[model samples]
Structures are given as structure tokens and as C-alpha cells.
Target: MRALVFPAILVLVMAVIGHVLTLHLVPSVIMGTAMNRLAAQGAALHSFRLAPRTTPQTQLVVRPSPDLAYSICAYHLRGPQPLRIRAAAYDDYGSISFFDARTNNFATIRIEETAPDSSGPDILLRGPAGGEPDGLFDGHDLKSPTPRGLILIRRLAPTQQAYDRVKAIASADVCALSSSAGTISE
Candidate 1:
């Protein structure tokens, strides 16, 4: 009985350790691979760029939907600066999602969430440590808990013709660092 008790306790301890390690490792592995792939594609910091078409060859992100056009902007709040994202209002469905380094989504803005009277799409994002923004131009303000993260822009395009149109609209979208001189440009 004594021997069995000791072995059972050891097994339980090992199981707990394994579980904790897995929880910590999985997100790191996934985020690391994504960051590496984005780097290889020449995705600059604080800039938005179109993601490659979902093909059997592309492995940066899993389960890519062929019916959608995806774009990404990688950001690092080194100086705790704000990021400005702008997209003209369109008739089709679209969204912008913010994810942290650990792959946790902190904030998301979608076309449906915008007011019907809203003129256009714009967002002001700051790091968790940054201050609030003022004088936003009908923009939504969001805070990210992490200093480094990704901004993903997804637009629906069910058919080739729709895809072309959405692609053109997405091409005009901009993500860039806000200037410190009280001016914003994309």
C-alpha cells in the first residue's frame, strides 16, 4: 500500500508538470512560427501588407480560407507609440482583429459594429502601457495588453469577381505608426 501511494503521487506530479509545460509551450511555438514566416516575407514593423494566397505551400497560418482576402500588420510598441489604421467604408463585410504575441485576441472591430452614419473605418491602437488618444476622427480606440502583436484585416470575397473588388479595397487600407509630432499618416 505504501509503495503504491508513492508511485501514484509521483505520477500525479508528473502529469501536472506536463500540463503546465504544454500550456506554456503551445502558444509560443505557434506565435514563433508565425513571426518567423512573416519576417521571411519582408513584412516590416508597423506596416500593413497583404498575406500570400492560401495555398498548400503556405504554412504561416493554419486553415486559411480561400474565400477571403487577408492582410496583416506586425507591430511593436517600442516607444509605446500608437498605431493608426484606416480603411474606406465599403459595402462588403470586413473586420480588423488584434492579437498579442501569445496569440490572444484582445480587440476586434467589424463593419457591423460601426454606426451606419459613420463616414469611414479608422482605429487608434495603443499598447497596454500607452496613454489614451485624443481628437480621433470618428475612430475606435483600442488597447492591446502586449507590446508586440499582429493586426489582421479580413474581407469576405465569395467569388472571383468579389475577390478582385475586395482586394482593391483592401489595397487602399493603411496601417502605420502615428507620428509623434501630433500628426497621423498612413
Candidate 2:
């Protein structure tokens, strides 16, 4: 039994090292692959791409909800301007989520939380190096840990008719530079 002690310790050390490496590196690897795939699929930087209804053959995400429509944007915050994201408000359930390079979801907004009288939830996203814009802007502000990331918007639409309606409503969703972007040069 004593002769097996060294082998056992070696195996345990290797397993622990592998676990630590996977935990630290896997998220970024997955996120990077996703970003590249989205870019290759015509998802331009700073623009919204409305994904088609989820079918087994058309699913891009890990496990997309069959009852929701999706819109995506692969954002690159390297420029001086802050990005503006606006999701059109709807009576049905909807949400917008922001993910950084490490696949960390840093922010999310629900449709019900938006102002009913306005177009929808408008948001300004800045990089870690960016500062708050001057004057007043009519939206929430967020600071991202990384300059490169993704934005995903999901709207509940279980059937064909519901999907069509959700798509139509989501057409108004905007992912672009803020109108006041010039003011925030950093």
C-alpha cells in the first residue's frame, strides 16, 4: 500500500491542475469561438442581427429556448464612442443580456422594467476605460470590464404567429453608437 502513495499523489495533483486550468480558461475560449462564429455569420460589430426562429438545425446558442426569438450584437468597444442599445417594448416577456469576453453576464434588463410611454429600454455601454458622458441622456449606463463582448436580446414567442409579432416588434431594436457619443471622447 505504501508503494502506491506516490502514484496516487501524482494523479491527484494532475487532476487538480487540470480542473484549475479548465475553470480559468474555458469561458474565454468559448466566448472567443462564439465571437468568431458570429462574425463569420455576418453579425457585424455594433449592429443587431435578428436570429431566425430556433429549429434544431438552426440553433447557434448552446441551448436556446424554443419559445423565444433572439437578436444579437457582437460589440467592440475599442472606439471612442459609447454603444447605444434599445430594445422595443412589448406586452409579452422579453429581456436583454450583456456578456463580456469571459462569458460573464454583467447586465440584464427586463421589458416590464422599461418606461411604458417610451420606445423601450435604452442603454449606454462603455468600456472600462470610458467615462460617463456629459450632460443628460435618457437611458441607463453600464461599464463593461472588457472592450469586446456580446449583447443578446430574447423575446417570448412560442408559436409562428407569436414569433412573427415578436420579430416585427424587435425590428425597432437598435444597437448603435449613442447620439451623444461625440461628447464622450474617452
TM-score, per-candidate, Cα-based: 0.82, 0.85
lDDT of 2 by residue, 76-117 (tens): 887556888888888888899999999989999996697687
Error of 2 at 106 (Å): 0.8
**Among all candidates shown, the one with the greatest lDDT:** 2
Task: Check candidate 1 and list the clashing pairs.
Answer: none
* Candidate 2 lDDT score at position 31: 93
Evaluated against the true structure, the overall lDDT of model 1 is: 0.76
lDDT of 2 at 135: 60
Worst 10 residues of 1 by lDDT: 111-120
